[model samples]
Target: MLRHLIARFVFLLAAICAPVLATPAMAATDVSTPWTDEDFASLRLISAQTQTGSSDTLRLGLEFELQPEWKIYWRSAGDAGFPPQLDWTGSQNVGDANILWPAPHRFSIFGLETFGYKNHVILPIDVAIPDRTQSVAINLDVDYLVCSDICIPAAATFALDIPANGNPDTSTSGASTVSTHAHEIEKFVSKVPLTGDNLPIQVSNVFATKDGDATQLHLSVDGLSNAGVTVDDILVESPLRIGFGAPVAVNKDGESNNRHFTVPVFGLNADQDLASETVTVTVIAGPLAIEQSRTVANGPTDASAQGEPLGADTMAPATGAGANIWLIGLFALFGGLILNVMPCVLPVLSIKVMSAINARDGEISRVRSGFLASAAGIITSFWLIAAVLIAIKLAGGSIGWGIQFQQPLFLTVMTIILALFALNMWGLFEINGSDNLGTAANDVINQQEKGGRHLSSHFMTGMFATLLATPCSAPFLGTAVGFALAGSSFDIIWIFTLLGVGLATPYLAIALQPRLAHALPKPGRWMSVVKAVLGLALVGTAIWLLSILAVQIGLGGAIAVGVGLVLGAVFVWARKRSQNLRPRFVFTALAVTGFLVALFAPGFSKPPAPSSVSTAATGPLDWQTFAPETIPALIADGKTVFVDVTAEWCVSCQVNKKLVLETAELAEFFANDDIILMQADWTRPDPEIADYLASYGRYGIPFNAVFGPNAPKGVLLSELLSRDAVLDAIKDARSTAGLASN
Candidate 1:
């Protein structure tokens, strides 16, 4: 038993260690530097002189010229990297060099979002130059990283002279450039339409609605009723995730007395129901930007609340910490029971039950041995799974469930198993009866396949079927495993053990029943038909597996899968057609050719997807994606960051996604520079990503850590989150990042 366990353990280890080969087209060596050779990668200062009587009137600026295609870190760089650091020490007669960031873009990389600049970006700084000084020299030192395929450290010292007698005309270049970039950045950052004093717009009402499966935010503006005056720019600041699925045009022509606007929340799918809650909206009209905080009726609000909207802040408080171990264990047990219904486990159960039906007349010892052998297979398979997970975690791979299936090779293996099983069921190969078969007629006939009687075969079958079951995790299983993954090692073992036992219970019950062996059906012609049907089912499943090949490898590569299948079928057919020695030679040649083709399939030899592509964005973030590094930078520049780490297989993750992450307040909070929200997808295990989570002292998903100026270390949120909770975090992070106290 120990040897068997060791062998299984070794195989599991090997599977995890196997390289995910990269194709030449997708493979590239890591660059030595994150900065472009020609770029001024750190901070620069630009100042504009204001009119007279303005005691030290000058707008100071922090300009960052990032390399083309490469980016500098944001306040929160998401899963990795640090935000840019700037210090201003050497200065004459300057009270403080306050940095004013125009806005930042959300940058998505390797399944994480960060807010920062790509190409060249300049953040304008506003400084009140004291009039008493004849001349002012502003000296600043900046440290930051420039990243392309890899990151490189960069720093620069900048000093700018402000002439006490210089003409306002001399400041055109600095003034114009700063103004232009600020407007450009704002264009991208403005998701929630804010109505500050700069925009002459007033919100009469703000409503939240569920449009089919998506949540949407509707706005009614009071001052928008004027004719000839239009609402050209509409940005939202609320946390109800909202975006335009189609192109949106805001033309303020001042014709109507009131105007209503609606935007669909991005990333939120159909996994949740809408609820009533207080919300806020930011409206940007002609020359004013108005921010209106109000309590909107929650969960599909009615039209009665329109125009009478009470402006109030209704942000929800974030849930602190997490549930205890016992709660998680209960969730795990329920998850285990649900695993019994997964399609992946169903077939294996069918095979076992069928075996039991056939061996009705076998001795208690033989029947018990078969049952024990199957049970052993289930347990052993789970051990192998746990071992692989543990090994990968040790190897710095923060992998989650179903991540292996993302690889084409694993899918190919599944395809091969289903195909082989189908062919066998079709009676392409036959064997003599097993020595252990009882006197039952049905047992005698079907047990002819002595190869399946081997303990190893039963074990392999259990393991293989479990692999198939990885994709369809029951709701209970997801929460259980999710909790286990986030908890202590002891919890992981016990939770997983409970699941294994749950899966093996049926087989155990039949094994313990000795007299049940006499119930086997008689061997008859109907048996052949049943086997043929099973064969067809297997073949159908194989085809389904083949169909998924197109998602990872393009259509041409999927065609290769079909060709490989045909080649394998031909080889099988050729073997069946041959009876003579010369024919055997032809059959052997065909089989070898088929084997080579299967091994050489183009999809099998490719490298795993790059570390830059994140599959977690319900779809994909807008072109302007953000990172974690942007958080500190935004805070330093006075902005908030909302961090979300989620996964596809995690049902709870999805539920929260539809509920909070995709809400307008949240999405707009992310879209605006006021608060930068970035998502880290833990759907697939990447070593770099694993290292990232470990840095946070977490080993699993649904983890949220929010950072603000007030709370730099970040407040860890509970596994289950709500829309209000997210907004409150944003408010806190914003207050902290924006320096509310100082």
Candidate 2:
């Protein structure tokens, strides 16, 4: 019995020491043995010789071939599962080793989205060879988890040997064994995400803000949106012991072509200083993926920064601030003065002209009362606009100039008003016994007979003019309106009042100068001709309003409105020609019914899908539909972008497009492959476009801007675009980019 126990102990001791003695010999040569975990996965150790800079590096690959529906975790194993951990202590002549991970896919099992790899994957271990004169032996004991429906832990020991200076002929077979595994290792090297300077994507800015107990990272990526690229997952790779939730895209107010991602980070200590920490973000967009590193700043470092804390008490400062308030007010004044010439406001001009003509025969007191009422009307409308802006701002909503033009209801109502006014000008109807001002002699008689009501008409005309002018933006108006909207409530009111004052300046001058009215052609047959001309202008204005209505509603709704306007016009004409009071009342009732039908008919139809209305040719310089998210990418790619923010309702925008942008000279210039012409049509209500407009501090359309490599922030163009102006902007942008590159 004693002899049997001694023999058993010797046998067990040899069994334990046998594998340890054989490890050195196994590692001395390339030990490639296939490892299988049941039927789920198969892994093997492979070795290759690679050149990194001036060093001969030994590349060892832990290649895994998984069965269908099975997957393994990535380095930053999100949600669940552990990444493969390697024990390199048993390896020889290996100064250092690193596992290079490829970009992972987001797997949604149940309701959880986990990051892992399916099918075949190779985890490349770059072994640093300390001495080129000596062979290097690598041994790895890896512990990894694989999952199908359930996860299973597996362990394996892998060994590989690389000859001195990667020489294969020194081996026992005198063959290049490292070359045999070269293709397999190269396959995975290509799969590894581009890092550092090799990354194709560019990160513009990264910001961190504390939201309750979690931290939100606002990442702004350039060119991602413009390329129509969308990310599936963003993994935060950092040494900090924190957990991150799935990334949610946050659309910045004015940046349609730029991508903004909001990533929620947990496990942040209250006292942690985010400004000093570096973060690596791996973005996987379709088949392409990139890894970029950036320092997390406390606040937004760029103008595109968004995703602020929900409970913050104060509003962030406006991006535009340096302009002098007095200068902006002056611009507002000039813009208002120029607004008088816009087609939308031309109908109001006729009213002003008629008032001036009527005042030519009246006393100074009557003229003063009439002009003062008009001025009061203008000022009151401006104040009302200010009140609406304040209400919107206080409610934590965005406010822009002429934003009402985007509302279908507002457009419908304005169309009805303009249509009726046009009919009145056309002698279908008369207001306050004025006889539609069909003849100058009749107008003179009416003004003499009803002076008080005539003054009221003048007042309403001024209010109507101001209302119409809101849809058009003039030179310097953007600067003024931007300042006002971004300023305090009091500033908004004060600045808008100044704008009204500017608009009324011409009327005030005419009222103060009685000789101005005398300079007009005498009230005769010429008055009839002038009335007809003014009536045509009003009709044109109504048509313009309806065109916008067509975009807001649909073609069907627009047709209905046209029919309603015609019916209303016929009834108004019948009422004007009627001799009996009952017949006139019946005609008036018909007109009212038609007007109501016109106003609400659009509400019943579905709005048509917005389509691109760009006139640029589909060639090298094809006009892209304006997407704010994509602008960054275009600029980054060294393309000069010309952005035109226009609307169908804006008369100035149409004028600019017809007169300057669509000209042969401009078209030729835009045909350059390096130049991208993009149009943002604000013909309908679009929150994305509205927010983009607000970002530039503009609330109105006909906004043109240029973006280039150097001017990624963009340079605003004049409201009235000229051929020279656009060409000059492009030239300047190119020159700026050249300078920046130099």
Best by TM-score: 2
lDDT of 2 by residue, 228-340 (tens): 44555677766787766667766566464666777777777897756668988887664446788888877878765664432322111111223346657788888778877
RMSD of each: 20.9, 27.0
lDDT of 1 by residue, 150-226 (tens): 78887767765554544433322112112112222222222223333323456655556775676666666666544
Query: All models: lDDT?
Result: 0.53, 0.69
Reference-based TM-score of each model: 0.44, 0.54
Clashes of each: 93, 12
- Model 2 score (lDDT): 0.69
Q: Name the lDDT value of residue 449 in candidate 1.
A: 32
Error of 1 at 398 (Å): 1.6
